[model samples]
Target: MSPPSGATTTFLLIEHRREIADLNERIRNRRLQVLSLYGTPIVVVLTLLVWAGLKIFIWLSSDTPTAINAIFFSVAVLLAVAAGAQFYAEFTATVWKDAETPVRELRLELSLADERHILEARRHTPPPTDRQASYKERLPQELVRLRIESRHYRRMHLMMQWLLFVSSAAISAVTAWYDPPQPAKGVLIGLGFTITVITAAAGYFKPRERAFNLQQTADSIEQHATALELGISPYNASEEKQNLELFATTVEGMRAEQRMREQQLDQPQQGQQQVI
Candidate 1:
């Protein structure tokens, strides 16, 4: 079989680039839409919770009018309904599905043409002479997977930290404001216990540290890949095949380290059986 002409390869590259750009745009827009859909409702609900807390304090301190209480209750109910409806709408939305259809079709076309696979292999994989195409493809994919895992764990770490702070603050506020004979005191005690547990868990897990280490490893791998591609510094002195082999070995080492870290994270605490 004849090799593809330069012009044909260039045309295919342009077409794939355009398709990827369009798909990326659509995916981004869909993400924004989903965030907005959920974010607005969450903000509203939090505001309502704060307002309810304030109202409860007011009611306990003094005799709030029946009309005022009734109105507040009605508004709360309305807000809840609105938030629930928005959540339902978001759940039922097919925006992601619709956006992915075109992307899938484009991917299928590119795959059949064999252009996409070649381009990706060339861009991401080590030199063809040093590593199997499959191994090269796997390395780039593993890099992406690690990056995603790092981000996810980072977000979770931050979220848990915030929850711990918020729960602690809630306990403090409840303790300062309400005394014995009030139900709020019991709530405060419960919150305090919960916060203690969360603090202990957070300390033991050290998710932030794990996330940071993962991120660093991923960044290192990415830097090495980029340097190899550009023929810069450490990679520049070596022949192409030697550089490719070194790159593969370096990436494999990083991947092994990442796997070890993941295993440590998965390890059970003393007396606790690890759950898959």
Candidate 2:
């Protein structure tokens, strides 16, 4: 049978591809934003809990002035209120709905396309011309997901690092500011313990390092894919099949390295549990 006209089929395919890409990007960004929003509240709430707990503990144990203790207590309460408000605002945000609308519309458009047009569109789309293209075609969705996760992990790692630094500094300042019997001393001790746990957790999880490794692997895969697509040096072989097999093997090796890194990160926790 005669194929569909080139102009119409090509146009449809290109438009669909572009729209899908746009929608996917929007969805990914929105999800990351949501993750960030939730992360802030978690940190804020945890800090408030620690602050309030230590404040109460010190107020009960020490002979600190009532007025000063009341002021600190009020500050903690205010902070709790502020954190709750922020969480409420974030929870009410509508980015998810906004992102989903376009995705649904795109899906509907695809479903409504005539079957022959669909086939024609697929045929009109360019084939994978190199190892890079093949890799992309094989794992387009996975690559996008990994990229998003890596970015999210990087942000989380940065936040944890900052919190660790600030908490440590606050502990030192608190210790230097007052005598041993002050209720605030309890607050400092609590913060110090929290900071210690955060430091240990950060070291054990190594989110920053994991994110870096994942990003590096993704970039390496992309670089090879691009080289293959361009038929550039090291991928400028006449035998396309051989080049593709080699590319796949290299990508698999990178993935294996990623798994090994994850296992190494998990070893500390495993050892602690075994000892317990």
Candidate 3:
């Protein structure tokens, strides 16, 4: 294999990879900052809604306590601060864009260089006898991604379910006893609504089902990977290439099946929207 040109060698250096990774991290941070700017006010608004609801109940009972008034004032101040932050973010959007522009342009440049570097590197490097080398390299990363996604959905489902059950139980306990005070009743009312919303979210999102599918897919892929390594049945092809091909095909088929199941889960929402 001929040595790559100086320019190609420089392009393939670790520095470019590090710079690209750094730029990506910076871009991600910037995006998160923008998201936070947008999200803060919305979160504050939701909080205000809940506080307002409680205040309304208090007002209806004609019991305007001093503590309630102070709490309301604090919420108002927090809302104002959130609004100011949002407005400042809006005003500075151009600044953010200017800062991000050069980073993006540099990343694009580095990406092109990286592509050329890969091409050059590939030209100089002998092809692997085992085609499965690349696939095996990627399989673990894919498995990790699937498992992470599974855990995320599983956690969300469990959290919502816990909230649903606890809220129901608390409401039940309260109702079963003596008649509650006005403030207690208002809190119970909020809990009841929370339960309803959580239930609806659980039903619509189907997080438990999503988690199950992702975990099952990941486990199947991992099992295939192990079987291929051990040369077990189905992956017991005499030819190494044939076994690798079988593993690749089986793993990809499982991924596709998981995707189909995800789409199936979404179909109900799509159907309802179409009908509406």
Each prediction's whole-model lDDT (CA): 0.69, 0.70, 0.77
For model 1, residues 121-216, the per-residue Cα lDDT tens digits are 466444466354336556677678777877887887888889888988887787777765387867877777878887887777877878887888
Model number with the top lDDT:
3
Relative to the true structure, candidate 1 has a C-alpha RMSD (angstroms) of 9.7
Report the error of model 1 at residue 136, Å: 4.1
Candidate 3 lands at a TM-score of 0.63
For model 2, residues 58-176, the per-residue Cα lDDT tens digits are 75576667776686567667666765655555466553444323445544554554444567665766545553454658765667767888998899899898988888888878878
- Residue ranges of candidate 3 with Cα displaced over 4 Å: 1-19, 30-131, 180-183, 269-276
Span of 10 residues, lowest total lDDT, candidate 1: 94-103
TM per candidate comes to: 0.48, 0.49, 0.63
By summed lDDT, which 10 consecutive residues of candidate 3 come out lowest?
Answer: 94-103
Quote model 1's TM-score.
0.48
Ranking by TM-score: 3, 2, 1
lDDT by residue for model 3 (105-212), tens: 656766876786577666656344344666777899999999999999999999998998899998888776746555578778899899989988888899999999
